[model samples]
Target chain A: AQSVTQPDIHITVSEGASLELRCNYSYGATPYLFWYVQSPGQGLQLLLKYFSGDTLVQGIKGFEAEFKRSQSSFNLRKPSVHWSDAAEYFCAVGPSGGTYKYIFGTGTRLKVLA
Target chain B: DAMVIQNPRYQVTQFGKPVTLSCSQTLNHNVMYWYQQKSSQAPKLLFHYYDKDFNNEADTPDNFQSRRPNTSFCFLDIRSPGLGDAAMYLCATSRDQGGYTFGSGTRLTVV
Candidate 1:
């Protein structure tokens, strides 16, 4: 079965500092990868996705993620984080052939310090 | 904008009472999913409707039921509320191989 792992449970970063959240997955094929963000008391919002061509994908709110096939990692990065960017981050993997089901990782709680 | 919308941002029900949470979509996606998210946990798939074909997860209890009257609407029904069932119920929609659009979710409290 497919699964995802986010090694960090909590990360605190100063505002305007660079940030990276690590994610790794287990899948047989070239998996569909995605990053999502969830604020308190709110639903998830799509951050970015890696489908086929580009190894690096850009997403909403100045976020980007790089898909590294060899390492089975798709880590999220932001050059300058904002205070409002504090939230929970989730990494998910889905099958490529058209199944919409996704296996999500344990979330990483991000705390942006001023 | 095309989006998924869930009703009653928050709900409170007594023990053993029946409660229903509603979800509607304007995206016209064929797949609608229900997920249960407890505090500090990832969302767990409960069931989904693929254009009226219901698919339930093996571990999903019989106390939970769902209804999809049409492509635009889906409902999650809890037959008997329990303390353990108190969690955020999230509704989402997606096309095959496409990213999901999620609603704000309904927070349920079993009193």
Candidate 2:
């Protein structure tokens, strides 16, 4: 079964500082990777996805992620964080070949400090 | 914009009472899914409707039922509300391999 692991449960970052959130996935074949953000009392918003490409993917809200096949990691990063960026982030893995089912990680709660 | 919409941002029900949460979509996606998310936990898949076919997860309680009358609407029915069943119910839709479009979700409270 495919699964996603986000080792960090909580992360605090100062505003305007660089940020990185680690994610690791387990899948048999090439996995469909995705990053989603959920604000308090809001639905998830897709941040970015890695289907097949140059390994580096950019997303909305000035975020980016790199898919490392060898490490089975797709970590999200931002050069400069903002206070509004504080939210819960989830990493998900799905099977290719048209399977829409996704296995999501527990999620990482980000706290942006001023 | 094409989106998924869930009604009643919050709902409160007494123990053993029946409650229904509704979801509708304008995206015309072929798949609709229901997920239960407890506090500080990831969303768990409860069931889904692929066009007209219904698929339920093995661990889903029998007390939970769902109805998808047409491509545009889906309803989740909880036969008997329990404290453990109190959680945020999320509805999502997708077309084939496309990314999912999720609704704001309905937060259920069982008293």
Candidate 3:
């Protein structure tokens, strides 16, 4: 079974500070990884995805993630945090092939302090 | 713009009452998914429709049902909603399986 894990349940960072949220996936092969953000009472918005080729992927809202094959990790990073950046982040992974069902990780909630 | 749309942004229903949530997409995607998200928890996949075939997760209870009449519409029906059913229900669309485009979810509140 494919699974994604987000170790952090909650993270607090001051405004203008750098941020990184860890995501690890367990799968037989190299799976497609994604980062999504959701505000309270709102639907999820895609931040970035890693299919193949590049190890580093850039996404909307100045977010970026690196896919490290050795570590089995794809951690989301932001150069600088903003007050409005507070939200829940989820990491999802799909099989490299076969059925397209996706597995979602328990999300990490970020609280930004100004 | 092309997107997945879920109706009734917020719904308040009495316990044991049946309620239906609707989802429609302009994305023309082959896959439509229903996810139940409790507060401060990950979204749990209830089921999905791939074109015309219905795929239900093994852990999904019999009380939860889904319908996809056409390529662009899907509905989730709760036969008897309990207080535990109060949560946000998300509808998503995908071309294949790489990723999904989600709609602003419907918050179901069973009182």
Against the true two-chain complex, what DockQ does each candidate achieve? 0.83, 0.76, 0.87
TM-score of 2: 0.97
Q: Model 2 segments beyond 4 Å from truth?
A: A96-98
**What DockQ does candidate 2 score?**
0.76
lDDT of 2 by residue, B1-111 (tens): 989999989999999999999999999999999999999899999988889999888899999999999999999999999999999999999886677789999999999
> For model 1, which pairs clash?
none
lDDT of 2 by residue, A1-114 (tens): 577899999999999999999999988988888999999988899999999968999999999999999999999999999999999999988853245678889999999999
Docking class of 3: high
Give the best candidate by DockQ: 3
Alpha-carbon shift of residue A37 in model 1 (angstroms): 0.4
Interface RMSD of each: 0.8, 0.9, 0.8
In candidate 3 the C-alpha lDDT for residue B23 amounts to 96
> What is the lDDT, from 0 to 100, of the residue B33 in candidate 3?
93
- Residues A1-114 of candidate 1 have per-residue lDDT tens digits of 688999999999999999999999999998999999999999999999999998999999999999999999999999999999999999989852255689888899999999
- Report how far off residue A11 is in candidate 3 (Å): 0.4
What DockQ class does candidate 1 belong to? high
Candidate 2 chain B lDDT trough over 10 residues, lowest sum: B93-102
User: Candidate 1 residues B1-111, lDDT tens each?
Assistant: 989999999999999999999999999999999999999899999998888899888899999999999999999999999999999999999986687889999999999
Cα lDDT over the full model 2: 0.92
